[model samples]
Target: MHPTVSGSGRLMLGFQYFLHFSVMGIVLPYFNLYCFHIGLTGFEIGAVSALRSAALVLFSLVWSILADRYSARKPIYILCIFISTGIWSLYLFTVDFWMILAITLIYGIFYSPVISFLEAFTMDALGVEKTRYGSIRVWGSVSFIAVVILIGKIIDLYRIDVILVLVLLGASLQSMASFKIPEVKRSRKHQAFLFPITLFRKEVIVFLGCAFLMLASHGAYYGFFSIHLESLGYTKTFIGFTWALASLSEIGVMIRSRTLFKNYSLHTVLVFSFMMAALRWGCLIFFRSAFTILLSQCLHSITYGAFHMSSILYMDALTPDDAKTVGQAANNAVTYGLGLMTGFFMAGALYEPIGAKGLFAISGIIALLAGAIFQTMGKRIKVFPP
Candidate 1:
């Protein structure tokens, strides 16, 4: 059998995460704000984001299926990155909402699967060292913090239109870095086990359901947090700082992920994250002060950092070795795709009628419900070894 990826390859993996998420750092915080600047309606913004999420679900699955079927994850991955980078360049030529939405949909077709595939590759490369994923993934957070803060300041000095350029630059670098990713070949014996029936245990279903709700609750924050801040009269720099703060807090949890998972059960971490998510959103419902908002951002340590790492590890343990790509794909599709799509649509539809405050209230309730149901149903789940 071919050996697992070595130390240099792991470093390449870290670099890949850094570059991939650098683009995310641009899009996540500022892309919608860019849309707002161009006079897109709230619903139109939501439609763009929601359709992109839909592409994540549909296209990511198709890519993963091909990856597993042909044992060609790396080639498929590289192709997607290059193609998506090319697609994203089309943004420069248009400010029309319909054109932008179409571009987002096309871009999503190639962009959606990149992360899930990277994650699956990461798990395979790490082998027994999976728990340390946070350390490597932490590089993404670092780049994210840097980009958001820098872009925020840049936007204050210039136009929001710069976001389009920055995203293209980041994505182009990611495509170049994609060539160095190490391939992990599976044994012929394992090839026969793709998408086995046993992959969908009740525990997996419950965890995924809870994960979906958790991400769904993030709809308001991801889709419109910058616009919400602007509505509150905050400057672009401050809005960027707020987003950077969340990622900064997320870094701490990720750095200590090995210790954290060793001391607490995934069940415990997941429930606590949900509880923190509820509290975080609930705070936004009543407070608008800078201090309060930054404090709320700190809770991202639990809400996203701990919860995400645990979800990845849990899914890795549950999936069979041969089916790792599809396993991660399913996880991504369910949480980021379906969950975020629903949340974005809900937030978009309701933003005009109820505003950000009302959206946060609904989000808090959704988070609480996720925690409650998971705590009750997830107790029986077996904790995988870190």
Candidate 2:
């Protein structure tokens, strides 16, 4: 493997995450719009959107297993990312529903692992000081906000097709930058067999379950918010600006998280986050005022921002010191890989009949469940300091 991430490498790894997920934010928000721009109806749009989640379910484990077995982190990230980017590139010419569906499926299988492996790569390179992970991760949010507002303005003047081209270019840049990241291998002893269930302990299982619910709560906003705005007669430019407003809040939390998480346990941060999600989404359910929409979006900081940092910290604290690599992979497998897929699939059907208000009500309840579980049972966790 190339020389491990010295201090210099950590900064580069951060930039890579920023670049990679930024591409994700740019494309994901507009994907449903693209489907509608074609002939697809609402149902088709949800299904197409969920395809990325489906892809994660199909491939996250297989890729993680490969990364662990051979200790080949960088190559796996590079290859899978390249495949996903190439598939994304084809969207410019092809708008057929079946063809689009096929591309989504391929993207799923190849795409989910990039972030998992990359995050695992980050932890391996950074070592024990887990606080910095958020500081780096926030850059992805920053890039996302920047791209969303810019693309929004662009789309208002030009055709939506510009998104396809920009997304392809961003994905390609991430793939290229990934090449410079140092390799991370499962240490020799972990190379031997170990129980996978070790990942599913009291604190961990709760955190994962909570993370799943918290993400599920996002289904309405992520999949349906643009449509909601469209219905409300907001222009594409305004919608994009609103979306960026949320990420801008998220960036603030991420920048402050190292200090916040350091003083407060990860559980403290998580409990507060889930509570905020409930309040934010609940308000969305009852209130349609623009101020409420803007207010709720700002809370993305607590709903997504703080909870994500806490989840990473919780993962580091819970995993056996020997199993750090596996721990990171398991987080992706449960939270993003499986949990996210489950949420998106359900949201596709639910959002159509229920509408945003009903959809968000359920989101509030789910976030409450997540919070209750974390607050009551999380105290019993063994690995975390009391």
Candidate 3:
């Protein structure tokens, strides 16, 4: 445990995660629906979504460098929350494709650093027992389940525009919560003018490559899963339930992540996560029945829950203390930024002619390839024991 972080502080951080992910649950899973509601075509929506990642790729490194240079994670985080909230609010007034694309790009620049800084804060607070991250992070999943279900019903009864109100509310609460977190102290020495290119050793490169492949595989699901379900005649309520089911399953994996870490190497866990992702996407290719969809979602426990936690721990172990924030930004830039950009753009182009089924089938194959690449890491990658 970090000497400065009290138990109450930990609880507050958990609440922050809860608030942040609540906003994500409302917006992320359904933003495509909102785009469609505002009259954008599938290709335009994908371009808008891809623009967000492009901004992240462009700006995350700049923000992370500033955070590390000034040792000001909390200040950067609070400013990002306010800026992103204001920019995101513009969505309510804009129906034009160009306008939405511009807003999303700007919003992504500010939003990119939020999670990376939070990860750095949380890891510092956890100290040596980094695996406990999942315990605190699981609250995010809980809030996601609650908000997704609630917003789904709200959209079902009212209109998708109501999601904007909920998103703004979550952002307001998150900004307030940011003030409660104590500023974490770190060494200001060894600040580099440029990110250390040498950090990309053979092992790190392989890990990041596999991570990119896995997230790229997720492009179809994240960008179009809800629309796909709706197209198949599933009700909004049922679609929300499926999302909640995945989060609920994620909670189980998160709560038990420490035990899993104790029993398995991070490499082992991540390889398994990749395999499960492959299987989950494979199932989506052939089976769209409610039961099969829900069953496939069960794999979220490993695909996201385990993969995310393990990746953070792995990165924490690999990077120096002074460079943690920048390290995390690099990881995010590769996995969520560039990787997701490729996936969204490709899925968008493929969605019309190839369809969701075909897109996911390709995703499954990519995930399998990612797993194979990770397997080659073998004993080269280090795993921290619980």
Q: For candidate 3, write residues 1-386 as lDDT tens digits.
A: 24347788888888989998999898777888888778888899789878888887768878888888888778888999889988888988878999988899889989988887788888888877777899999999999999889888988999888888789888988987888875567767655453675256666788888999999999899899999999999988888888898999999888888898999989899899999999999999888689999999899989999999988888777776777888788788888888888889988889999999999999999999999989976458765324
* TM-scores, all models, native as reference: 0.97, 0.92, 0.96
Q: Superposing all C-alpha atoms, what RMSD in Å does each candidate have to the true structure?
A: 1.8, 2.6, 1.8
lDDT of each: 0.90, 0.75, 0.85
Candidate 3 residue-wise lDDT at 267 = 88
- Of models 2 and 3, which has the larger TM-score? 3
How should the candidates be ordered by lDDT, best one leading? 1, 3, 2
Residues 1-386, model 2: lDDT tens digits = 22245777877887887898678667767878767778787667777767777667557766766666666657778899889989887777798988888888888888878777777676667566667777778878988888888888989999988888888889888888877887554454543143365555566777777787777777767777787788788888888888888889988788887788768877788899989989998987766667777877898888878887777767767765455556666777676656666566666777778776777788789889889988898777764644
lDDT of 3: 0.85
For 1-386, candidate 1 gives per-residue lDDT tens digits of 11368889989999998998788888999999999889999999999999999999888978987888778889999999999999999999999998998999999999888999999999988887788889889999999999999999999999899999999999988898899998788653444246654346787888889989999999999999999999999999999999999999999899999999889988899999999999999999988999999999999999999999998998888777777788888889889998999999999999999999999999999999999999999997766623
Predicted structure 1: lDDT: 0.90
